[model samples]
Target: MKNLDKLLEKYAKLCVKVGINIKEGQPLVINAPIEGLEFVRLLSKNAYELGASEVYVNWSDEVLTKLKYKNSPMEVFENYPKWKADSLEDFAKRGAGFISISSDDPELLKEMDPKKVAAANKSASIALKEYRKYTMNDINPWLVISIATRSWAKKVFPKLEEEKALKSLWDAIFKATRIDQEDPIKAWEDHMGNLKEKVDFLNNKKIKSLHYTSKNGTDLKVELPIDHIWAGGGSITSSGVPFAPNMPTEEVYTMPDKYGVDGVIYSTKPLNYGGNLIDEFKLYFEKGKVVDFSASVGEEVLKDLFAIDEGAKHLGEVALVPFDSPISNSNIIFMNTLFDENASCHFAFGKAYPTNIKGGEDMTDEELEAHHVNNSLTHVDFMVGDSTTSIVATTLDGKTLQIFKDGNWAF
Candidate 1:
């Protein structure tokens, strides 16, 4: 691929300045793909320039991961290394900023043992459960960004050669993140303001529940917890540092009531979950649980997903995105959740965000459960909205408002 040195620099700057908002004297922990080593070098440089005290990199290689999974014993997947968990937790304790560059191959683990994959994921989640709280509760600033890898790019543009596919995917990513603009940071500020408007309006509505209907056979009702906070664009840590959790963010989301979702919903896009794709799926929800589901592709993977834990059978998040968003208008299914979920309204199955509820960070597990917050080892988002989708909200006081009509903001 041709080098875009300046463009890559701008991207790293935007992530450092706006994504994690690297604070002076604050340490940074970056999880990047081995393929992105050059990018990581640029990121470390940018972070240091912004006065980051130290930068730590944890490099991952999808090829290696798949190799290990293909040959490793099942027992190896059932136990997580204590030292790895300790390192992450220690970083969280020190108020370090985290940047995770997710660039997994959508089909990296296809045909691999689903049992091993599921078990390892579950074990890792359990090992780092406490570390997750820091990110989930906004206790520390953390950001999730994506990079174009050969495998991922090929999946997105299979007809193109590897180089062309990479360039195309990179162009799309830069466009989606506004990094292609002359003043990308300024553009993001303006975009953030637009998203904030929607967040403020939804917060003021004091919505009790939402009813979703669409031509794609989605008809569902989802209830929100009392005092649930709608957040988007960026968030502030308890200590006041600001950070954007995801690049190319377009949704203002909050947690759903664990036991308050019911009806049927159809997926509008394929879900590349943990290296396996699940598409053309329909989930039947009853009392917030996944009573049943059907997926034309990867049905066994779907079964292994919710079977990770009890909370996997229920929804933990409800995010609102418009069908007319920038990414949606691109008309490309990236097959990556970080981008796809931003393109349309989606729901996640697994643990809820503590930051979504008032004083939720301080709430005990039992108290959170009492407040209808679901807990699980997984938080997988699947798109379920399109141009024909409509959403109506009912406020606590009985007034109703059209939140989305024909898949775009109606307010």
Candidate 2:
């Protein structure tokens, strides 16, 4: 018990020091599940100790949410509380750093209607579009980290008892985030440097497009926009504050032109979307749109996912993760995108981050649209890389360079 408490404290401190890089006098906001309240309290304490002027928490309960979904009318799903949306906007306006703790059962909403879930998500996103723009543009630092709950742990390690599974999952999370290291902050700094090196290498190549192929029926071509930037590791906010958006991040990604993707790709891992598991899925793209798709499970959910908005059918982000990442090597199916997406190469459908385009943060919506950047209320990532996959880059100068072979960077 003592060791567990110590681990949680250390993890919270790492989040405060490195993940959000909380600045002196900065207000901090955390969105976390009720199951993660212990860690949230620790994080709030750590943030205050690190010079945060104030700490705000937006606590959520999965059971309550499920009950609401089950009992609420369809019209309720369409309404997003203005007060909640305003609060998030206010946080961005005040330059408050944001931290989100993810720890929900993957199947928490499996019994609910997919359309209603999609409606609720879409409505909320629309109501908070301004807030989304602020965060997506990196106006303020934001970090997303994960915690282990009993239900989530059980999903991961079904064979183990509840207590044992929770501990095992916690151990896995700590190791993946390098929190198990003697000096986790220093370890992260070194890891960030290594990732930056890879980004620099890709940027120097000035590739105009990428071609992916595998024996698993993936033959895709993704065109990169002019002045596109491949970003990962730590990112600096508009005010020059540095923060890591996702802990245990292994992918350096860029936005794919909204109208520039063409191929048929198969998912290498299952995607747990809104507590629904989508597996054995394949997407057929034409001119950057998902013209067709099929999934062995959660087919209705997949259909509803792409129907969120017009931009939902277009590609937003293309990320490259080595097939040999620490999380992938662990041989654990977390059933969570936060960890699973980092385990393999993936692509997102919906809104693209403005930071991925050159001078994009300051660009007008029209300008961004002209640059072929996607804009939508949703961003869903699905794994698509494995040992059988290979990626090659085609430079503007007509040079073909190998990027990945057998799912690892070839360089």
Candidate 3:
């Protein structure tokens, strides 16, 4: 086995230096899954070494969530803990660096209620939207990464033994996140430079609309905001401090007009909601709003999510991940949206991106509405890539150009 201790130390240092850009005397907050305990602990130790004032680790366990699903009452799902809400606010006000880790056991929810799972996860956020708003606004720097647990490693490599699978997945994630470079920081700088090129090209082209079509789908016409900034690779908070968004990412994304999307789209991956798995879901949109949705499983979860608020039904993030992405080349269907979206192009529902739109967050509700900035606490992403799916940009000058062909970037 590779020296796990050394790996943890190296990973933590990278997170502090490159991911979160930990500053002296800065407070740090980690929302880590139990699977990531080792990395979290090492990160805390590193934070102290970096002169952090305090390091808070908020741990979550899928087993605990499973128990709640099996035992908690329906009403209990709606109410959130006041302390938890306060904690999010505290982190935001303190300008704490937020780091999140994802390492879920894929089969844990194989038999659970997808709707109930979705409800449980969304309940806390809906109850704490204000604090979430602060974090989303990049009140401070933030970083997110994934760890390989026994179960997650199993999901990634079903044929291998636990130890081997873990090593393999670890190698994959490390490489994908650019942790193996001789100078990883410089590697990120170069990668972000390439992403900036794509964004700059799109921004300069003044693309006014996006049109998409595939075999069973032929229905989305999206309007892009004038002066919108296409962001990808890494992002700085409103504070001008840089941080990594996705652990292994290759996408330039912008917010879509909440009221400007029209058509039907199919989900390319299974969704985990309310501790249950929802599969084969299809959504129909009308005038930038999700008017209807259906799934072979967990339809109720989607219904409840749509009922959250007007903004919940609107689109938030519109991202493009090329078909040749490393994760995509793995050719393994994780059945999880996060990994699946990283493999290919995807979009989200709810909570618009402030950086994507010009003056997005500062705009009044009226002003934002005019610009089609979607608003909601629930931002859910789903994959939509297919071999025939393509994207075309309609320039502001009324010229049409192909940007992607068969799930690949044309530029």
Q: Give the whole-model CA lDDT for all candidates, comma-separated.
A: 0.92, 0.92, 0.78
lDDT of 2 at 236: 94
Clashes per candidate (backbone, < 3 Å) = 0, 0, 9
Q: Residue 395 of model 1: what lDDT?
A: 99
Clashing pairs in 3: 113-276, 114-273, 114-276, 116-274, 117-274, 117-275, 118-273, 118-274, 261-288
Show where candidate 2 strays beyond 4 Å.
Answer: none
Residue 22, candidate 1: Cα error in Å is: 0.9
lDDT of 3 at 296: 87
CA lDDT for candidate 2: 0.92
In terms of lDDT, model 1 sits at 0.92
Could you estimate the TM-score for every candidate? 0.98, 0.99, 0.93
Model 3 spans > 4 angstroms off: 113-118, 216-218
Q: After superposition on all CA atoms, what RMSD does each candidate show versus the true structure?
A: 1.1, 0.9, 2.1
Which residue pairs come into collision in candidate 1?
none
